[model samples]
Target: MNPAREENPTLLDGFRDGYSVHLDKFDGPLDLLLHLIRKNEVDICDIPIADITRQYLDYIKLMKVLNLDVAGDFLLMASTLLHIKSRMLLPPDDEEESEEEEGDPRAELVRRLLEYQQYKEAGMVIGARALLGREVFTRACPDPALSAARTEEGPLEVSLFELVDAFRALLARIPKESFHDVAPGDSLNIADCINEILSLLQDRDTLQFDELIKDELTSERVIVTFLALLELCRLKLIRIFQNGEYGAIWFIPAVAPEQAGSAGEAVQSPV
Candidate 1:
């Protein structure tokens, strides 16, 4: 016998009194249910509710013993399983009983579990394909126009995650006091706003927040312009700086040819 298997012989045992000894590996209630179905060698099309219910409760007990942080979702599933089990156990009423109705009370549960399992397997397959694609790839050919554009400006340091976070923070600060109305074609195009900001930065080196918003505009346009600034920052084509508490932001263009090459090199190198 394998040493690992010998060390935990009871781990392979099938469900007894509706419970199994080997459910500790599961991360959630669905995982535990899947393990139980597999261990019993039972068809997912037809599940025995009473047996699974007892097994589920047994695992819950083990979870409590191990002091596992069981989520409410897990408890809710357990309650559902128990309810189905009780329904199965109750004697059928003479008037409601139908001979045509076939299969177990837990059939719906089995169907859902099987569907979830399929989706989970598909996700794994997709993830594996993504990993393979990342391993064998070619560098994109350099664009001379893009290079020429970068040569006119300096580099600025910023991260994509930071830019996204900053945008989220700006959205959170929008006042809920008065609802702003925006008609069709009223909202400014994000791309146009990006170009406008780029033009201002190109002319003045840096643009203050109030100066950027000085043009007559609705709140919706302001929000769109802010998002545009964030997108530019995310692309590493712009820099945003704030001085102190309640201070206005300064937006500046960042364009450097060598910096792009260095970023590409960094991605190619192993950590």
Candidate 2:
């Protein structure tokens, strides 16, 4: 935690101790524009260029003040906004020239924003569906032992973001110029990685997040192992959890005798 943020709870509690992300967490220039539009409740098709541009510039200034690196795309968007604003101020040569030279300066921007908004909304819907799918569980006759275990461990599921963050932090610790046997056709497949994870859990009930990928010296292997971990969690073959906030995650085999027996019976039964 930064000493400057000690007094600000909101800064401390929000988004990983208010770690400044790419473009202050907005996906890109269009995303920032969309945010300003929605926040001001301004019509996207009829955006007030002067007002929105001012707000966008203000955000960029704040980013600079906070020492957050502003990407080239953001600056490019700023220039576009300024150009459009300048075009709006010029006098029209004639009705034809007016139509051709400065016809609705924001038309292209509006179209892009609309298309991006639709895809963003659709992504939200798909993400919600995925969450619902992960939440689905089989209800069996109550068992005191299982109930106790559930009570002891709050939830078996961890957010996918945390897993990605853990992977990134671990990856950062590796040397940038480390030697590797990464040849043209030497990439590790996710299936092989999955089998390896299962093999490890055979002897031990759980393994640390780093333990699984410690041997993956190359980026390709690390990525495949991460994907394999995600696939295992998606299939309910393993459970990821942490002891406390910002604690190391552990991947534990999700198989139980009851589940194994049920799986065996299902396989033996007629299709």
Candidate 3:
């Protein structure tokens, strides 16, 4: 797919999209629902289904925008959310059945979510192992610069969803009135953007994400730069870290050794 520089770009969560590649490696729909629930800091037992449904569908659109395979389970879960939402909207029955837990529209979903959370927590790997994945690129050795940067900054590693959230915030800071039209003569190139990012990462332990396009805030510019960042992460050339949740994000050069199989062998965090 071509770059998302057109006037009518596909948008979700404030980010534009044009790529059409399958990201089968990502998590499932329930995992995404869990993410949104946690993100909103709402009670899983009494989920705000309407709001959660909206956010869940937004994620589905985003997955499609990224050309990811929308697994059957995701669609099934979407319908389930909508069904629960509709049922919740109906007035409670006049009978005492309404007072029973079985009559609650959200009961089943709450049950599932609680069970899933238990399984997820049970399987959670400890420490850096939870932070690393096989899809990421790796190096055979560690770097003093990375160690030194960590010593001074003490930033925590972040997940891909967190990165997307930050990117959305970045786009929101730009005003619609300041938008620039992309001319064919100034087409965006992913390869060039990747090289530009590499140059920025050189001789540095951690690079500020916003600095990549600090000089240019156009939508096209931001979109291309983020895409490049995603590509780099996918290739395992760099890993992202944040000072804290909702804190300043930093990019650090990293490598995974061929024998890197666990936290004991690798240093980078997982997505």
Top TM-score model: 1
* Superposition TM-score, candidate 1 onto the true structure: 0.47
Q: For candidate 3, lDDT tens digit of each residue in 1-271?
A: 4333342232342454334433324377778888888878999887899888877876777778667788999999999999988877887677756566467788888888889888787677443262322434336314433443354445768889989998998899877876765455757777677767665556556689888878988777788889888977886778898875567899877654222223212222231
Candidate 2 overall lDDT versus native? 0.72
Off by over 4 Å in 1: 1-27, 94-104, 130-271
Candidate number achieving the greatest lDDT relative to the actual structure: 2
lDDT of each: 0.62, 0.72, 0.71
Query: Candidates' TM-scores?
Result: 0.47, 0.42, 0.39
Model 2 earns a TM-score of 0.42
Count of residue pairs whose backbone atoms collide, per candidate: 2, 0, 8
Ranking by TM-score: 1, 2, 3
Per-residue CA lDDT of model 1 for 144-217, tens digit only, reads: 33333343345333344544555556555556542465456744677667767665665676777656655644
